[model samples]
Target: MKIRSVVLAAGLIGFSAVASASSFVGTTNAIGSILANTANALGDSTASTFGSDKVVLQAREDAASFVGSNGDLRGVNLEAALGHIRHQMPELQASDMQLAEAILAL
Candidate 1:
């Protein structure tokens, strides 16, 4: 087969595989709710800092909710996304709503 034909065939196979798979889905929650929950977890009303709680909360079954494979987006994306927010807009935290949409779209 010609190189072009082989590439076309592979593309078709990949497209079919992707189309056959179920789309991952999820919902969203308020960022305040999430942060408040984190605060509660830390046992400090005005701890005013995020660290282990953030990581723990992210992996939490309820906090940073999502669907599909456990490593679907990988920890890297989550970290990178948070970093982007820090440099681009510290005030803007990734809301569950946004995360849900992103998860579902994935």
Candidate 2:
């Protein structure tokens, strides 16, 4: 009886994790789309505007990547993803550490 109860509890926890991840995936997708749309509306198609857009796009990409790949959100595991993100924008990644830290905290 104890074994059966433990199995049932584990199954319930698994189901809840799956449901929440599914919901967060949808939210991630929507946020990426909105960021792209905002970038398009910046009213300046010059190099600077394009550069600004690049930063926004990279952030969106990183957030989406995190949500999709983070089945396990333990601190050490996230370091690799953080490195992957730094490859996209070396300056931003080097200068600003808060973004990735905040993402992991979430």
Candidate 3:
């Protein structure tokens, strides 16, 4: 009877440890997921804001495609896009390169 009690106690202790470890792993995964989701949301918001302008939206596809194909920002499409952005949004404070890069990113 004493040996049976000892075996039962040991089994219960082992089960408890396993359960605790599983719970900890679950909590950690949940926190990681939350952090990943938050970062993705923030990135999406910034991208949307940057691309929201009609001028930027109009130029984005061409500029991005040119940059992707040419592997640089020295293309007619990119230049035209930059010029259009400048002419349309003169009040914008960003430089030509910055605008080109932004267009490429979009």
Off by over 4 Å in 3: 47-106
Candidate topping TM-score: 3
TM-score per candidate, chains pooled: 0.23, 0.40, 0.43
Instruction: Indicate whether candidate 1 or candidate 3 has the larger lDDT.
Output: 3
Global lDDT of each candidate:
0.44, 0.49, 0.63
Per-residue lDDT of 80 in model 1 = 51
lDDT of 2 by residue, 1-106 (tens): 9999999999999999999999999999998775454434331322242234434434444544554554333244345444544565455422123333334233
**What is the RMSD, in Å, between candidate 2 and the native fold over all Cα?**
11.7
> Per-residue CA lDDT of candidate 3, range 11-106, in tens?
999999999999999999997685456435533543565566665567666655654554444556556666766676667666554454465455
lDDT of 2 at 7: 100
Model 1 lDDT tens row, 1-106: 6999999999999988776563321113454465445535433411233333344335334224343343344455455544543454466454543443332222
Q: Rank the candidates by lDDT, best first.
A: 3, 2, 1
Best by lDDT: 3
Candidate 1 residue 86 Cα shift, in angstroms, is 3.4
